[model samples]
Target: MSASRTERLLNLLIALLNTKYGLRRSELRQKVYHDTTSSEVAFGRMFERDKGELRAYGFDVETVTDKGWGSDDPATTRYRIGKESNRLPDVSLTPAECTVLILAAQLWEQAALGSAARNAVRKLQAAGGLVDPELPPGVQPRIRPAGQAFEDLVDAIHSQHPVTFSYLAGSTGQEEERTVEPWGLGSRFGQWYLVGHDRARSDKRFFRLSRFTSAVVVLEHQTFAPPSSFNVREQLAALPELPVRYAVVDVAAGALLGLRKHARAGGDADDTGAATPVPDCVDRLRVPYRDAETLAEELASYGPKAVVVAPPALHAAVRRRLAAAAAFAAAPFPPIDFPRSGPAKRTRKRTSEDQLKRMLQLVPFLVHNQGLHISEVAQRFGITRKELEDDLRILICSGLPEGYPDDLLDIRWDDDHVYIIQDLDLNRPVRFTVDEACALLTGLEALNGLPGLAEGGALESVTLKLMAAAGEEGLKAAAVAGPDVAPEDSAVLETAREAIRGGAQLRLSYLAPQRDAVSDRDVDPHRLYSLDSTWYLEAYCHSAQGLRNFRLDRIQSLQPNGRPVSSAVDPAGGFPVKLFTPNDDDAVVVLELTRQGAGLADDYYAERTAALPGGNHLAEVRFGSADWLPMFVAQHGGSVRILQPANLADATREWLDAALARYEDSTARQLD
Candidate 1:
């Protein structure tokens, strides 16, 4: 019987680790390969692949060859992993430091780094270097890497692979293909950017993730060495801010108050002379803008309520977006293949590589937690009891080349409790992977911006200790990306936390964008949590008689009433995983999403989704209020289209058509 790949790799790792003088290729093949049917050439190929895999897993497989006779001959080379080089050194951290580290590691909410951070923290816990501590109330901070492109770029940067993507150039307003040797990725000015060597231009450049028009494709077969001192944060910081420009617009009275607040009356002869005629209730104003595309998106969202009069470029951009939205709204819905069994539950496939990584960490964890229940061990590793048992069976059969009873890993279970009698020098945790280090370090830095999370310089002390443990490579990888939270929001965040801690209700003057008004409301403080860079307060609203989420930035004023909370509702367990809390009264709307906008389904927490042709999706989403449905459709340009609910589809089409019609006369004049 042929041995499974997991068993083969385990045997190979054991053989290599136990060797003192390093074993020759022929000897390693003879010792590790249980299947005798394979040819010598095939065994050689498999051995080479296994060696590379081990190296990738952070093992330093050293090659040793005799100098006297065939020093340069591949046949004479022997391989072994140095124990001192491969093992993680002891890390001693204080309880306070452990608390801060745990928060830092959990900062990546749903990004690729989130899992990496969890694994890193688990390893630290296994090594007895981390003590689980209670988190601060009403102070949860999270950073989300934009999308799949952000994740793909991170992987490319780690592997030093070049990537190709279509990017819309903000400067030229053109879409172009770019092949870049990804150096680092970081968030700056509330946007994620990739700093890399552009192969076409043969110069370093920064590309914004939001500007990417296509999926990132990594050229794994090709790789390059980035400069050792390359830092993502520094490169992003050096980027010059875009020169701000102004747009003249006519906004209807009592409409788009958010826009009017940042705008001033436009009366200059040059600006007003070029302005198109507006109704008596409309006010002409000049609004400062940095990026025309970004401003255009915002203006398009207002539908016919706001019109860009001057800055022909901005006006034209807005008109184009509105026209596209209107065209999509009026178009026929695509055929959708709904699943009869309902939406498929998300499942993660456990590959051999995943299992091997888990086993490596599992050994050290079991060493620290002796006689733990088998079910508990399986739960900790996010696997089933049967899976854990299978792993244990495989481990017991793996050992040194001699395969003696004592030489193998001794795993015993009694009364549903599991214990590792011998770990074969794997009791110590392995060093952090690059992604794990980056996730943790970036998260810690983000927490630095939040007020009063850690005190007595514990945060800084922990950061320094982690840097030392991460080594040079880990530091370089971590430097590629970071998260930034606006420090200005700290005051409001502190106030909300205070209210929650004091068990007092808060009287808040909050801006309701949908209603275009600022209203005062009293609410019992629940919790303060942040998703990405935005902080939200989940509270029980007295006005609405239910739970509501208020943006900290939009909170005009907050004063704690000093009265004890009256609500009987407990805010402990119902913390939302998504920004929107679906209510029974929420309108169930169906929509179609283009390939570019398919991520919106996940963002909005769609109730059901069906696959359509051309990379589009049919989603059934719940809207708290459908008042903003038109804006949502227009804001996404033509990427989103309202499908079902005949009234909504017609309303969105009419809204977009009216917005586009406002530019008709100006467009005609230009053509003449």
Candidate 2:
């Protein structure tokens, strides 16, 4: 069989590392490119490309020439990666430190950096520097990078490559093509932004990831150097605050109470030069807003119940979004196959890049854990024994250009125990990638704000240790990124933590948004966790007689009732993978999600899903109460539409129609 590029690269890496005086172009061609290349030009191109690939993987391949004879020739140029430069430096970490690091690494959740953080922790484990320590129960903090654009920009920044994308200009509200030398990505004011040098404008620009209108295209085979002292946080901090504006909206008297609470009870005159009279069963509100786009989305979610009365721009924006949503919801869709088992588990294809990354980490791991059982190694790397064996086979044939038995890596599995007899200079873990470092550091910083976690200055100590080990450049690059987590009310959060630690039954005044009512309930606190910056307490509600997740912000008043807890529920076992837990009695609602709303399938814990034409999907989801369905439909605009459970769909359509009719009546009055 022909050797794959991954195998060839591994062979080349092995050959380059094993050399003392470095290997010349001709020697590398003979050793690494013998079977792959047909001519000298092909060999040269392949070798150069491989060198860059290795460098991209964090290996610094040094170039040298023999000037000892006082005769410098371009042909004498040789290349090799020094062990000292490529290997990670030794750093001592306590069990507590390792535990904190693990927690930090696990914070990426579903972002692209999640895998990188895991890989970083695995390397630490392989080196025997990590220890398993008990984490705070139910406290899983996660940060999700905005989307595909964030991942692409991170990669581009790491490779120092330029990127091109279509960006929606905030001022003009039009999408324009932009080519930028991506310097760093950071989060500020609950949004992620890319700080880069705009090629067309010839100046530094900070772009919000949310404003991106198209997929980011990384210009490979081209690179540019960013400013030496560039820092993402500093750049973002220097940004000017946007001027705040006000919008007048007319909402139903009893509905949308949350919106009403934040707004004042008066409105300005309408565009027709007359005082806007509040319609019967409606309340006019003057709401302060900074971003029109954000406000439009929020208002559109109210569906037909809320209408902008003043500021033509705001009204037009809200109307446009609602019109789009109503059009999409009213559109006919193909019937979906329902009442199926569930969404089929997706199988990810193992790519060559993935294998290469695994092998690079595997070498140092096996070196540290000699004579480990073969199965254990496979399990650790999340691969099968056969795959591990194939990787071993490839490595065994890879070595120095000498082509001697001693030059190759020695391996044996005589008793189902794998051992690496020789690993050359690849016996130490590689340095952390930029993404991995940023994920860990940012997570650690976030942990500092969480009350119960990181006691005894462990978070700070760990941060110092990591910064010292990561060096200046790594630290600088990592600083280009930050996590955006909203600060929870400290007094309320501390009170909740105290209750959970003390194992007490708590009496609480909680506002249920779905029901739009505040009710007092007795509950035993189980665990406290946050998802997407919103803190939720999973508790055994005496009233509900089941596990219920209550948002911390909605707790009108929380104080322990000074009673011992009676619920014998296991706190560790009940932590949900998602916020909502489906019950048999819950209503099953089928939804058709546009490409924009596909993420809702995962967010809502869809039981079954099937892809439709044009990137739309049919999802079967469970709703504990159908009362919130109309608001859910409106909140997401046209992206989410009810397709099944005719009664619920009809109710939602009726609600939208009523809201739209109110707006039309108001428009007719204005025309008159």
Question: What ranges in model 1 sit over 4 Å off?
Answer: 1-3, 64-78, 267-275, 323-350, 370-393, 401-407, 410-418, 572-577, 587-602, 605-623, 638-658, 661-666, 669-672
Q: How far is candidate 2 from the true structure (C-alpha RMSD, Å)?
A: 4.4
What are the per-residue Cα lDDT tens digits for candidate 2 across 32-151?
A: 767453776766676778888899787889888777732235377888888776566676788778767877777676565767777777777666667776776556666653555677
lDDT of each: 0.80, 0.75
Error of 1 at 2 (Å): 12
Per-residue alpha-carbon lDDT of candidate 1 for residues 1-672, written as tens digits (9 for 90 to 100): 123887888788878887889988877767777548888778778877888888888888888987765644657888888776556667788877887887787667555577788888878888888877777787677776476677788899988899999998877777899999999999877778998899999999889887777778999999999987887877887988888878888788868778877888863322436535555787888899887877988999998888777777788778878887888788877765556655332223468888888888988899998999999898777678988998899988888886679999998996889889988877887788888778778888878757776567878998888878888656776556666654466778888888889898899999988899999998998887776668889898989988888988788999887787788765647223456776899988988987566667766767778777766778888999998999999887887998878898888888888888877854675455
For model 2, the stretches where C-alpha displacement exceeds 4 angstroms are 1-3, 23-37, 63-79, 160-181, 197-205, 211-224, 242-245, 268-274, 330-350, 366-424, 452-457, 472-479, 484-486, 571-577, 585-630, 638-664
Backbone collision tally, model 2: 1
Per-candidate TM-score against the hidden true structure: 0.89, 0.84
